[model samples]
Target: MRNNHNDKPQWQPATMTIHGGKQRDEHGALVAPLYQTATFAFSNTAQGSARFAGEEAGYIYSRLGNPTTDELEARIAQLEGYPAGAACATGMGAVSAAMLAFLEQGDHVVVADAIYGCSFALFSHLFAKFGISVDFVDMTNADNVAAAMRSNTKMVFIETPANPHLKIIDIAAVSEIAHRQQARVIVDNTFMTPLLQRPREQGADIVIHSATKYLNGHGDVVAGLICGSAEDIELIKMTTLKDMGATMSPHDAWLILRGLKTLDVRMERHCNNAMRVAAYLQQHQMVRSIYYPGLAEHPAQRLMGTQMHGPGAVIAFELDGDIATARQVLDSLELITIAVSLGDAETLIQHPASMTHSPYTPEARAKAGISDTLVRISVGLEAVEDIIADLEQAFTKAQQLKTIEQTEQTEQQGEPLTYG
Candidate 1:
């Protein structure tokens, strides 16, 4: 929307979720109609030339922009309280565009040691080949980030309530360090979403999300978003997004737009269920370590509480035994899904070491805090009691099977096994 004297009223979160940044069609459809066309028609050659010359606001092709996608981007920007944003075909699309948009061949990027596996690969491989250097640092300590910053550093990238481990990074602290070096700060707010944590408000220059996960919430679409100032988004739109052709489809954008309407309430239930599940796991004998920041024992509890409204749905815990036993417990889960993706309505669980982060070397995985015995669960909207009951039974089954396996191994070795 262009700036005008009759600007719409800015609503609060609840009200915005239902009515913010809407582009009403002539039919007055309550839900935005899916404009599934690839090309838009102009009234005349002069009008088309005007659009191409930037004198008019109009979409020429779906690859550059689509009405449906624009509506979603507008809504996301509104929710993030940013001047502009871009919706992309997939989560990595947004990540790649945001990085390539600002980075030059000799520029350096400082990133948190923990991020999505693909993000690490993109930085370590593709970006490296182009002469862009990246430093992966322990961002939990603000000083570590400050120390990593260089005169050549152009961006500081981080993920809060970070992937798999749920380590909370102080966005304000890192942003403070980056701004001193004249570097931009970009944060992946996938885990907590804007409802729980708004990174832009915490001094971050840009915010990105895997809209496929919590943003969609129904496991139906793969999408991403980048939120920042209009000038930054425009640079990405005209270059990386347009040339790479990572534009979100009209249908996918529509689905994500639908998701925005319920994000506030769904996040509320997600946080509530996760807190209950994390509390239950902490006291369980089979659980060796709990990685939910909501727990008081978590190293980042104070910082997390200050930065975010809640800990969110994803929780990581390590087992008392080996990878075999962890797999056994995951396989034994009847209610919780054994899928890799998170933020679905159904409970989903997976081992990051063998699943998401399998592409990384053992040392790399270790540095990222992904362990063989670790299991990450995306707590769902199910009744807290039922979710806990399912885990309880699975843990009991895992222990029994693990004991049997140990006994058999002992017998094979001809060692007399004694009772503990």
Candidate 2:
């Protein structure tokens, strides 16, 4: 049974992370026990049939349900302020399950122009093969979303502080527009986990998370979660999740359960470190442009403390030079790891054009405002000063490389290089 928070004073986020969906251990253990098994044994054939028929609430198979995974789902759902949730093997599993469950052939989906690279590929390439049409639009302006909706538009997908660029979309405004046309809003809440922003409370119909990132808060496990009303979650579980076989492993679920206990505090450090990193990038001469909501110069800075509790840990910026310059800086960095994923204890930096968003064609990426020179970083739990110092040295080395390259070019041409 779920813990009854209503019986006591309302739990805060930190408390909720530790104890929200947890049940007392009948064995008098401090931690919830993991139910690692393929299937549960029924009392009798009649009981087995009843479970298969959904006439009784009991685990039939690991794919259909597991006690450990169930607790993870319940914890996330409660954190999202939703009635139910489904855990998946990966973040894309959650995205596909949520969309495929509700969408049908000939259905049109309106989506944010900028989102995770894999998510964009899923809709543009795979969905087309199934006869579903999609329109990628700028959700920052609610009017763009309104204009894109159609009579057959069954869903609208978005990512606030959109991937790689930190573009802030107005969740409530888009939700209002989509709801008017009978479309449900599915929000990818990976960047700003429920600890930072609850999309359901902001009018989103469904919320998705890459449990591989912030939810797991470790580089070890890869998983996903979807939270929504009980009906929607049931629909997803019965359809895509059940048939696709993307259910999360019991071991992974248990790791995430342990990770969630530290989520509230980790998010605090992430936000704090990110704000400082963003500020440093803003004043740096080599950073041509920075896209972090915490910075006052960001167009969507106003959304902070209103739609979101804090400006999350991810930051995207452009260097003074071209893509080569960005690569040089990345290669020169000594401290931050050159990696694709985020929300781990160690800082990670990657080039969106070549790494994460490579699925998008050049034209599509341009339209989405993801420049070839853009660098995205997930500020980690390291000392803020050390992170800045590493970035500072990297930028200096990149500048030195640029000067040497210019000199070599001038020598090869037998003349000084000139700039317009």
Candidate 3:
């Protein structure tokens, strides 16, 4: 049951997404059927031995591979312009496995400073404990990254339009520099799905995703994917993923496959909604600053235009007051969920200072441009007017809280006259 859809030259991305990696069983089902068995039954002892010895290209165990997961992997690889891909249990699982497989104790890694908070912690804490030194750099500065690279550097890790801040990095430039130094370039492409930006096309050796995000288009499941050359993927699969046991579940893979079918449509709507939200935030008096690549005011707007098809769904803004005010706004929101993760069907608003990056020291958070007043929002597929109205109400509530705090402080100061 082999599908040769990839060999067809006439097929485009949208077409490939629907019919790309599908292989029919004997029943001739149009959709790829899920093989739920733990181990494959062999016709004879020799066949089983050969299958175990890698003499045959059939599934030996569900832990290693499944037909439904394979179809999803192949489809994602085709969409990403990669030779192959591997699905993992979660996005961080993919990141950790890729790093552990490729890097050694003595190796060094150069990472973007503005990355997901957990990813930052993984490198700064976990990798460091293993004697793998990681150097964090502002990827927007090519020269800074170049200077940070050492002879022992094995990989340069980055997330473009970085997690909360939306800082853009020149993927091509960074990849070239890393490659010249004999370092592999790994990009977290969670923010911009392959439909919007293909990191492999820009010279990335590997592209990773928290498919829990846009790939799922809903907050129901947690999944991850890694795309790279077949050889590189095989190495990671044989080593980290196999030993660490971070394989994605069959059910999650199936759900993600369903989500992939509508990925292009969902992302288009997400980008459109995000742009409107960013515009509205930029004009609001309460918003001290907005960080969105779509706006001309953004520092990386030009680079984003060159490297990405669109600005993506996430937006970050700073409040005129402080962290307390930011929390007030989040607490007041009726339509948006105050959750930690992003890229869901419903809008989610979070304060990184108190929520995501709270584990990091204040100085470290400052270095990453995560300020006390900063608020991050993952705009969803909701109606633009309704989303704006919810935000408006939140802003009103936040202002009321601010006014009360100021009045209380003034009264306390007035009462201090008796103490003198």
Candidate 4:
């Protein structure tokens, strides 16, 4: 059995990352053992019945819980400063299960207009099909959130430094407004991990993460986690997670457990690299606009230290030309990988309009300020100089492509091509 020292001192974040929720087993193994069994053998029929009926606290089945997955859940919950957490198969699973646990037919949800493409689809398309209504509102201004709330609003969902776009939402203000109407507030804390921000302290009812991203720090694992009150977590675990069967694999949880050890150092490197990259992009002539909270000109710069500990590792910027130019820039990158996923050891870039946020129609995307030329990059743990060098080369290639396209257009019109 694992030790639960109730009188343990409050360790710092760095120490907690390595040791939180971990204890030696009967064999005194330094690393926690993975109980990979599907079902635990009961000593007797009475104990089996008691476990099934929730009268006893031992693990009856892996679907209900596993020692490995439980450690992961507890560790993440401790990081987020919540009483409990539930791990899921994917980020969308955590999102769907968290909301579905409390929502019913005729219930309304107020969500930020800018969110992950899958999340937007969940609220705009899938939930609507099931008779649940959602109002997508601009959450940067708390007043917009207040205006969008209805008497039937059961939940308010938001993503601070919202996916791809990097729009910062006021968690405390929105949470306060949601709580007034007896609605739960769920903040997708995927962008800024618990190392940077704790939404629960700011009044958010639950904190969610796409653990596939920063939490894992490596790109191999595809997983999600939600941290909240013990009651809310139990409800999600019993209903959506148990019946829907989006349980996280014990192996995956073990990988995340390993990843958590270096989270503090990884996040620090990510932030430093991103801040340098955002500055470089800001000065590039081929770039139209840059969105990163670390930049001085960022609209949400004032909220940096107050809301989040750092600006985070993602940067979104628009190219000077059209969608083709943006695509060329991504295609021309030599070192950076062109993948939609973020928070990896390798730097990655992707176009949101055709990639991550394509779930939204053109009209809806335009309304959400996602332009066709916008490109999002998840600045990885790469050396800052190497990351910037790759971007510089890509921009040079994109600019050359633009020049050729312009020259060809002039020739087609029977006009002399003017050189700049």
lDDT for predicted candidate 3 compared with the true structure: 0.87
| Deviation of model 1 at 183, angstroms | 0.4
- Model 4 C-alpha lDDT per residue in residues 171-253, reported as the tens digit of each score: 99999999999999999999999999889978999989999998898899999999999999999999999999998989889
The parts of candidate 4 lying over 4 Å away from their true place are 6-9, 415-420
Each model's total of backbone clashes = 0, 0, 0, 0
Tens-place lDDT digits, model 1, residues 117-151 = 89888988888899999999999999998788889
Q: Per-candidate TM vs. native? A: 0.95, 0.96, 0.95, 0.97
Residue-level lDDT of model 3, residues 1-420, one tens digit each, is: 565455443677667667666665677777667666767778898988888899987887777888878888888888888898999999999999888898988999999988888898899999988999999899898999999999999999999988788888989999999999889999999998887788987899999999999888878999999999999999998899988999988888888888888887888889899999999999999999999888888776676545787888999999998777887888899998999888888998898887888766788888999999999999999998999999999999889888998899999878554553
List per-prediction Cα lDDT, in the order shown.
Answer: 0.88, 0.92, 0.87, 0.91
Best by lDDT: 2
Enumerate residue pairs that collide in model 2. none
Most TM-score-accurate candidate: 4
- TM-score winner between candidates 2 and 4: 4
lDDT of 2: 0.92
What is the Å distance of residue 187 in model 4 from its true position? Answer: 0.3
The parts of candidate 1 lying over 4 Å away from their true place are 1-10, 413-420
Q: Which ten residues in a row have the lowest lDDT in candidate 1?
A: 1-10
Collision pairs in model 3: none
